[model samples]
Target: MDLDAEFKLDDDLCYLNHAAVAPWPLRSMQAVERFARENAMRGAAHYPRWMEVENTLRENLARLINAPSPRDIALVKSTSEALSFVAYGLHWEPGDEIVISDQEFPSNRIVWESLADQGVTVRVVSLDGDDCEDDLIDAFNNNTRLLAISSVQYGTGLRMNLDKLGAACKAAKVLFCVDAIQSLGALPLDVEKSQIDFTMADGHKWLLGPEGLGVFYVRPALRESLKLHEFGWHMIANRGDYRQTTWQVAPDATRFECGSPNTMGAHAFQASTELLLEIGIDKVEALVLNRVELLERELNKIQGIEILSSRDRQRQSGILTFRVAHQDSQALYRDLMSRNVICASRGGGARFSPHCYTPDAVIHTAVERLAECIS
Candidate 1:
């Protein structure tokens, strides 16, 4: 596929904020427009077809993450909703412990922290040491009920070794949950191989889709362990059989989705995921990493610029965060935005996250603009 034809970014603007909300691809936009037109013209006349798109989306997400089956996937409004499902669904005893890293995003942090009322202790481990994985794994004890961590730290762009953490969790008999918003589309993720009990990611970020739709993956065996907190017709096993009075909860991840599906979001994200699959995630990872490398190299040459993100290749991700020495990060962020360099101010630095489709010219131009702005 000709990627240039797919991404129609403006010439004057350089988008380097895929870690935040990403601009939708052409196909996703087209899909949304088509869905809108159909809704306006026919008014639910094509509802069945929309459900088909939703199912296809689940399959695409399953394949993207190498999930065992589409049955393991649930379409949710956001990553927060999915996390809440696991958070409230599980039976937490007083004094039970949950292990998480200190660098987690608010969505990942707040959800776990909110369980304090139930006497559940949230252990926040620092990932600043040489042996970060060991630091996290060592935090687990007999009381540790689960370990929740991001696949990549959002602000620092530090990619965690999920395999190591997953293995440690498995050995410790601890449930593993991953907030994969940062790495899901830019990198390959295997739930089964990594032994992840639960995982969730929003579509608006690296997936290059619209907001209000995300994926939640729950391992098959542990599906029933989570008590159902929400109930509706959609979550019933006999969903189509409205006449059936005796309805059982869905045998799959759909049990988490207690209401109507986001048909429009499903259409948009399905197109986006299809684009990512067509390009191949391996190729996407390579392209994104190459861009990150280029940004890192260019930033390194400029004086007074301190790269905040990890330099280690294994820890590096699509995010490259840095700061100009002796400068306020927010001020620099504003200056960059003024220059049409779309990035973010995070972790005490300016964060630039380029996607696989980001052009070389954009990276070079953004770097040159940074140099000029600081000079």
Candidate 2:
């Protein structure tokens, strides 16, 4: 695939915010367009084909995360919904505890914390220590029922040692869950290697797809342990057999999908997922980190710009956050937006997250635009 041709962004725009919402590649956009046209003219005549696309997406997602099978993947509305599945479905004891990092996105934190009514404790461990992974591992005791953390922190872009954490969780017999939105498309993730019991990520971010669609993975052995709170025709083993008098809940992860599928979102997300898989995650991670490195180098050259993200190679991600001496982060963000430097105001600074396809010239231009924002 011609990488440059896939992303035909505007000449004046420097898109450096893939960590938030990524613009879809041409193929993905075209897939949506084709779906729209087919819906208009052909109607449900192409329904079976659409189902195939959705199933393919599940397989692709399984491949992306190295899940045991596509049966482990559930198409979800968003990461929040998947998190809710675990939050409400589980039978929690009054004194049970869930371990999480302090820097989790609200989707990960708020859901777990909301379980306080059930007398569950949300243990927020500080990742500020020299060895953040160890800090998390140490937080786990007999009371800890689960450990939920992001594969990469949203603001500071600190990549966690998931394998080490996973191993610890397995040994401690705690459920390992990861909010993988920030790292899924840009970095390679293996649920098996990491011993993750549950994981979810939206397609809009690094996946280069639209909103309203995401992937949820639940370990097969623990599937029934999470009692389902949502029920509908689609989640049944006899799905589509509207005339049947008896029904059984799906035997696989599809049991979590309680309603009609997002067919349009599925088409586009599958296209985007296939594109990333074609490029290969290891190659994508390398290219993404290279862009971040360039951003760090260029941003450092400007006067009074202080890099806030980690410099450790293991901890580094596509995100590079920085702030100016006298400027407020939001003010700098607005200024950059006015200058057509597409970035985000986060981590108490301006965050620039470029994908694998981001050009070096765009990275340099974004840094130059930031200089203007401060100057």
Candidate 3:
């Protein structure tokens, strides 16, 4: 398949910020168009087909994360909403503490920190200098009720050893939660082997869908532990039985989904995920890593650039960040953007995150353009 055709980006611009918001595949665009057209022509006449699309999305997400069943998936509005579901859903006491990395995106940190008013404590673990993987495991204690971390650090693109962390969480009896926004589509994830208690990701980044929709995965055993914070008709077990005065929460992960689904997001994400499945996660991972390696080598050769991303293959992903020796990172970010080299300023430098579909010429051009701009 021609991946370039899949994205159909403008010929004049090169998008290297998949770590931020990504452009949806052409297939996704077509899907959304069809969905909109159907809605205009025949409203609820095709609701059954829409539900089927939603089911397809759940199945695709389950396969992506290696969840045993589609019933474990809960479609939510955003990563923040999903994190909130877990943070507020649980009952916490004065001394209960949650463990998290210092490098976490605010979505992961803010939710847990908000619990401070409830007499819960949030411990921020620094993952910068020391061996971060081991330190994360060591941070856990008897007071630790849960450990929330990003699968990949947003700014530095540090890929954590989820297997090791999962094992530690299992042995320590602490709940394991992963903020998978950065790594979901770029890397292969297995919730079962990783022993993750909860996981969530917005489709706008690596999944190449829109901003509003995200997926939340909760382990089967821990589902009942979280007290429901949001409630609506859709969350009821007998969703269609409106006449029945008495109601019970849905038994599966759907309980987290309180109201009407974002059918638009569902249509778009379903299309995006189908392309990822066709390309295969392993292949995508390999392609992305290769591009990142090329970027690193090119950036290293530049006179003023300093590569900020980890050199360790096991601890790296698609993000390649670098700072100019004498120029301010923000200044360089502005210069690059002004010149049409689309990127972001992150981890104290400008971050360029390309996907498997990014053309090699675009990578070479970006590096060359930076050299010229900096010089």
The local distance difference test score of each candidate is: 0.94, 0.93, 0.92
Write model 3 residue lDDT over 129-178, tens digit each, in one string: 65897888887888899999999999999999899899999999999999
Count of clashes in candidate 2:
0
Residue 192, model 2: lDDT of: 92
Model 2, position 374, has a per-residue lDDT of 75
For residues 335-363, write the lDDT of model 2, one tens digit per residue: 99999999899888989899999999998
Cα error, candidate 3, residue 245 (Å): 0.6
Report residue 33 deviation for candidate 3 (angstroms).
0.8
Pairs of residues clashing in candidate 1: none
* Poorly placed runs, candidate 1 (over 4 Å): none
lDDT of candidate model 1 versus the reference: 0.94
Q: Identify the superior model by lDDT, candidate 1 or candidate 3.
A: 1
- What are the per-model C-alpha RMSD values against the true structure? 0.8, 0.8, 0.9
The C-alpha TM-scores of every prediction are: 0.99, 0.99, 0.98
